[model samples]
Target: MVNAQQYIESSFPKHIYRIFAIGKNLEGHLDLSEYPNLVEVRLGNNPLLTSLSLGPSPRPYLTAIGFRGSGITNFSFLANLPNIHMLVLVNHTQEHQAKIVRDINQVHQCKDQEIEKIKQQIIQLQQQIQSLKTCENSNRNQNSPPNLSSERNNDTS
Candidate 1:
């Protein structure tokens, strides 16, 4: 059961790629900016952790992140890691999971609505373009003079 002070006191190698601090008592923020090559991080079972801060800079190589059984409530730190593909949030209570799911669904719904609005705007622009083409065709027909050969035949008849 490593406490926050012990974990912070320990020095990690610069080239370390993966970290598994399970059951460790981590508190406040955990900055891993020193490990530029880090790829996978698993910090589950840390009930003392309230918030996690990946780093001041972006972690381009980070792909997998897990935080099961932790007391973390805010996940806004994930927005910085664009390459993350796997996220684990298991071991939480059923009620917590339900709330998280509801929040995710709301965000998904807003995104879907925004996409539909953009699609409608595109359709409206296409219709406007078609109407302009039709108007231009009508104007060209009205402005052009009648054929001279047909007029001459009419006069002779």
Candidate 2:
């Protein structure tokens, strides 16, 4: 049998600091634990992407992760990740919850201000890190590299 994991470990660039493959048609699980110098990863909006695992190698340097619309619901791998600073997990899996919150907000006008404050708190809680880059649904070029600061999703699969 072909050891896909070993093949990926040997083939992927060891010194890579980032992996931005946003809006690609990628599916299934992705484990990126070989590279020790990784600092960021942005894999948003594949919609089909189920699982993602990172660290135990790049745990110290890995700081940012953006998986806005990948459909990944489990983040247990990041429970004790100390160096991590930024995490953007919105859309799809969170859509139902957000919808419920919005509906409740509309119905409970008396608690509008309190609900607004709670929403801010929720946003702050989700964004544990500094630089956040997610969901550029307007223009996503899946043919090139990403320039997140400029709001471009040019990441290829």
The lDDT of model 1 is: 0.77
Cα lDDT computed for each candidate against the true fold: 0.77, 0.65
- Candidate 2, residues 1-157: lDDT per residue as tens digits? 2233343455558788887777766677778866667788887886767777775433767789888887676664563344667877677556655653454345355356678999999889788533233434323445457667566444432
Candidate 2 error regions (>4 Å): 1-12, 55-58, 92-157
TM-score of each: 0.60, 0.50
Model 1 per-residue lDDT tens digits across residues 1-101: 45553484374566788888877777656766666787988889898777777766767689998989887887756655656778789988788777766
Query: What is the C-alpha local distance difference test score of candidate 2?
Result: 0.65
Error of 2 at 134 (Å): 61
The numbered model that scores best in TM-score is 1
Which model scores highest in lDDT?
1
